[model samples]
Target: MSVRQAQGPAGRGTRPGLWREGLAALRSGDLRLIWLAQVVSQLGDGVFTLGIVVLTVELTASGLALSGTLMAQLLPYALLGAPAGALADRWNRRLTMVASDIARGLVVALLPLLHLTGWLHAWMIPVVAFLLTTGGLFFDPAKNALVPTVTPAGALVRVNALLAGTRQVLFIAAPALGGVLAAAFGTMTLFWIDAASFFLSAAILARMRVSGRVPALTPGPPSPRPSATPLPQGGRGAGGEGSPVRGHLLRDVQEGLRYVWRVPVLRLMVIVGTFINFILSPLPVILPLLFLTVLGLGTAAFGTALSFIFAGFLLGVAFVGVSGSRIHLGYLTTAAMAVAGLAVLALGAGPPLTVIHLIGLAGGAAVGIMEVAETTVLQRESTDAVRGRVFALYESVSQGGRAVSVALAGALSDRVGLRAMVYAVGALTLACAVLLALSPPVRRLARG
Candidate 1:
């Protein structure tokens, strides 16, 4: 199907009514099921993250080992995200997501078993982390690609915002809850809960009816070979014959790349996302280290700071959910990016714990605005057929940027001091925002 046809009433050309139409789709049962599943799964993920980290620490005291475990969880996105995204486009998104949930559940279940049997070595953390993350590589892209299919185009911003808000809520509540659960019931119990959540998510998703409309690729003209079969009935081609399928997978990938490159707004958005992630990724990796080494804080203090960040994110998401669609998103994005940079700078400057928490909150809020706006822009601009591929590239850039940031942050903190590293990253992020503001495409988008 052509882009125009696929977009139908939901296309950009539609006026204010399109938004209402989108909202109607979101209110449907299928979409609600997906949203609910996402919430449950994300809550589980939040708890699992805290529980696993604490579990690893209990087994070993080395900071590097903990970092290594984190790295293992992240590496799958860097390595397999593109291919997994392609697979998501090829297969049933619902099935892909269901399978991912099942796989993750099994992985989490193994953690507790490993602990109970005294077989939980430091190396085991990375191995399990990698396996669980590999499932995420499939799950995320599938969920993203499935959204436009189930929800209305006009309602996308609101739906995205709502989902983002839920995720932020999970971030806020999960760590603290996980910490509490670990203290009261043990880390192994948290893993079991995490495993159960995934199964529950899968069960919910399995019942949703998602009749996704697959985009039909243009076929190539038929050849004159004697054995060449006539074009399938009603298949359109040049000269009224079935057009040969001109694009290979590699070619399709290239087409998606070109599409992003040619669209000035998309290009600018991708660049901003890449840079922001580069600056932000280091925060989580280094924050714990800074708390321990520089601030002389314990795990609980670090958790408190992290919670403050989540609090900021919740506030930001709420603000955006209320006002984002009405605002000129481009300007919001630029301003948020700059504010985030400043927040990070403040974080690194050795403020008191209270001040630090405030900075974290502010930074998280800025990130929330950026994420909601950026994702909405992408959804609005792209066609459904190529959306998966485009998002794949987006995910790849995000993952790669983050990985680089993590590695660089760890190195810089060790060599130049955490304060200098944080300030440098912050300044660089500020530069990126300035560059984004100056770009004509980004400026135009902001105005829109």
Candidate 2:
């Protein structure tokens, strides 16, 4: 029997209809493994981020130097993301993910070695950051592409909610623990912990079994494969030549870009996401200065502010989970982005800590809502064959926009003051949200 046939009714014996389908997908072993791996990786990533920043500051005490390190970490995604996406489409996603984990683990493990030898310098930090993120360039596309393949069609929203919720948890817990670890064992020890976490993640991933084997591209018809049950209506892997594909890497990159541009709703999403990133990019760079210099707070206080934002994020995630199928997602997305922008503006208005935390909470909630909605939209809209490449381009553009925004923020904040910069970014974000809401294509896609 065909794989689809053997599996019986597509979503049979599932809970009630759409909601049940989504829940079952979330509960699937494949998606569960992916979620588990991501949770582990994100937590480790938080620790690594804290450790790196603390270590860099200890070594160089220069804000410019730290900014440069962050820039280095982000630049690779901007530079290499398209090619990474194409490669992901052509490769076995499981292998791609595992290799990424292993690569990150090895790179992080070398940090202590460099530190012990006194070879770690402020300049070297950027290079290491680049290498680390380069691995992510490969990992992210593969992972995003894999999600739709494993889940039931109706379950995309719920799975996305679960993913968003886990990320919220990581945001809340990881940095706090990272701070404590950095204070106690030092930053180098945190790197060791990060490395171990990567290995653990890879081990977990090794056990997952993705349904469709990504076929090696050649000059002929795609290899025939064993069938699972026929997927549901609007099921994935339905179109295309299904042929062994071959093309120039650059051409593949161009093809991916063209594919994204051709889709009107996806294009709108890219634009909106770009604007949001532009608005938020300054927070990480300028917020520390604000807290330390303007608010007269210590590192611990700054961490507290971050925690407030994360707390809001957790609440938003929960909200998304509970209302995944019931809400008008597009409207929610528009509202969330607007609220996030406004909250950022409020954050800069010099309110008391209680007020600041409230603003942070609001902004975090907005971010959580926006992310889950956005991811679900993308998963539903894209074809599996092209999904990785498209997401790669998405990530690359988002990171590139963020880099530009960071640069702009730094320059603008330096000249006009941080408060003005915050207010300006907030205005731009709100404008983008309005634009997205007005776009007919975006509204239609959200309803779908």
Candidate 3:
């Protein structure tokens, strides 16, 4: 358990240094495998999303079709996230991740063949996307909840930062690569590659050490050695006094909600978070509109701007990983939202495209800072009993927020100018930050 500690502001080392902690986790053998599995899976996801977009364009050339496909990709979090998370607590996390990966690989592997044989239809894209997303509903929370199990105490920040940073980098690179590969060979190639990534992810995750929380086990005859037996507690086998309440799926879902509702910080965080999620959208529509219609800039401009955001985000993660203890995470989150607001304003102000890219870069960094800060807080604070459900609720609500944004964007994008839409986004983001600063409950969060 001994590892290198990070230096605090007063010059004393307080927590584990990022690289040292990461290496420690890697040496343990579980965290590195989990990290690798996620990285590979995300690469596949990037290509898969790109391939789908290309296939959609090839099939129908309709905006409505594209929107539907996008929704299919996101909505499963809203629909099944709670149930899936509840199940994660009931099942073995490693097995859940492995099964989900294997299932997804099998499903995604067939998509390219369907297209090659002329069996793929435009309607089926959303259907397949929905199924894949369903797998994600199970996979994501399980993966998240596993971090505390695998990572050492006080090093959750480094572990979470690594996970978040990796995803952001992949998100930036994956789509572009997928697009190129799709154009060079075909969308089928992208699909096959993505399928392979999932299979590899599954193979790696299957070997991880943590068994995670399991279902309620009935007490049997007492052991002769009283100290050896584990009492059932909080849907897990913990050493405790009385038998814990055996939670059904519905009850588990309720317990997650109750925990959030009772915690002032989590309650307020989720509320403001829903609004942030609504406006701070990396919506599929935003980039295309910026590149093609609003800015009238080519893909090169779009690519540059996109890269700025991703790189800035990764940099921000590195910053947090190194200096998380020095900053107030709640304040960091508020400031990040404010920066996003300014980025929106810059986008709408008709500034030079280079200036716009710079602003986007800064905004991306702010978001990266916000993401790791908030997640570290949550991951550090939450107990294993409710961690999976907490993540599930957050995902569900965030996706719901995105749905609201999507609906607004669709309904208003044609009625109003894109500039007007950008302005509204900016204004709402600022308003959310203002509300966050004003809230007494959120302020108290930092003290605890």
Candidate 4:
């Protein structure tokens, strides 16, 4: 049977529909292995983030230094995202992922080793973080591009939802566990654990039996002026000295960009997703202020409110995994945006803590739904040849938009009141939803 035909709606016996279907991807041995690797790596990531903060403070005690270190970890995604994706497309994805994990493991191991040698410095932390995150950038696109290969087309939503929801659960749980672990064993040990996690993840990935094959590109003549204008080059398998099957890396990046722009659904998704990211990025800053300044709540209340948001996200993921195939993605995404806008608008009212939690839950669910829809569509629409690059472009732009949004929102919030800023964001989201609803191409995505 075909892969799609092999997958049926999984929950036939006694398991809860949501749990059964959401975890259905685990039934596939290859996908289960990938998920297991993610669980290990992501948990380690949580601990690693905490360790970074603690280590940086111990080394520098400078808040600015801490911020810089954190930024270093994030900067690579925006800077190298596209090229990383292109590399994933060009190379064997499984090997690319394994290499990335091993590289990250080695880079992380350097931290504890450096400290043991009394050679570690505050500056070195950020440098190592930058390299570690660069490795993740390559790993992410490769893993994303690899998932569809291991999963049935009909099961893609369940797989994506499962992955996203697991990350969310880890996002909530890992830091608390990290804190306890750090207290029992020094922060240096956290690095060791994280390094070990990466290695374990690499081992898990290396065991997968998926094809190592990649798209074969046609070769062309080498550029005459190879000195001044260098082209991205692939290894020549059977052709002449200048003839590699794949184009130059630069040219491949260009093709990925052009492919995204030319594809109407992808174009709409990118533009809309980037804008939504911009709208949401400041929530980390804004939500805290909402609780403290506006609602006169404490840290405990803020944390609880955040929990509601996460819970909502989990619910949203479950909903999509179960029902997503039956719905039109374009419509679902647009409607989710509308709900998100209303939730944002409600937040501006500075309601009681309970009400705020409800709004947060709704808003979070909206975002969750939107994310799964967008990811599923991207995977469905893009061909395997360019899929990694497509995801990389989307991620890079989203990261850029998020960075810009955080900066701009902070500045704008000071000039205008926080509530006013919140109101404006809500209005813009609703407007964007309207734009999406009106786009014929977006509406026709699942239809076609």
Best by TM-score: 4
**lDDT score of residue 220 within candidate 1:** 32
| True-vs-predicted CA distance for residue 88, candidate 4, Å | 0.7
At residue 425, give the lDDT of candidate 2.
72
Collision pairs in model 4: 232-248, 232-249
Per-residue accuracy of model 2 over 1-448 as CA lDDT, tens digit each: 2222323554343335545555677688988899999989999998998888988899899988888898899898778999999888777789889999999999998888888998887777777889999999988888888887787655666687788788767866898899998888888988998899899999989899774345333232222221111112222233343433556788778766775776676777777787677678888889998888777767887888898888888788767755655566778888998898788778778888888888888988888889988887665556666678878888888889889987887677889987777778788888888898899976775544
Off by over 4 Å in 4: 1-24, 217-244
Cα RMSDs, all models: 7.1, 6.0, 5.5, 6.1
Clashes by residue pair, model 3:
6-15
For residues 1-448, could you state the per-residue lDDT of candidate 1 as single tens digits? 3223444664544445445554676688878999899889988999998987887888898888888898898788778767666565555678888999999999999988877898878788889999999898878867877786676534566677778988878877887888898889888888998999999999999998875433443343232221112223232123321222334555555666775786677777777787778777887767788788887878888888888887888788767755665567777888888998898788777888888888888888998888888887776565544456667778888888898787877678889988787788789888888887888886666554
Clashes of each: 10, 8, 1, 2
Candidate 3 on 128-238: residue-level lDDT in tens?
Answer: 899999998888888887776788755666677788999987887899899888778877899899899999999998887666544343354122211112233344433
lDDT of 1 at 418: 81
Model 4: how far is 28 from its true place, Å? 1.1
**TM-score per model over all chains:** 0.81, 0.84, 0.86, 0.90
Query: lDDT winner among the candidates?
Result: 4
Ranking of models by TM-score: 4, 3, 2, 1
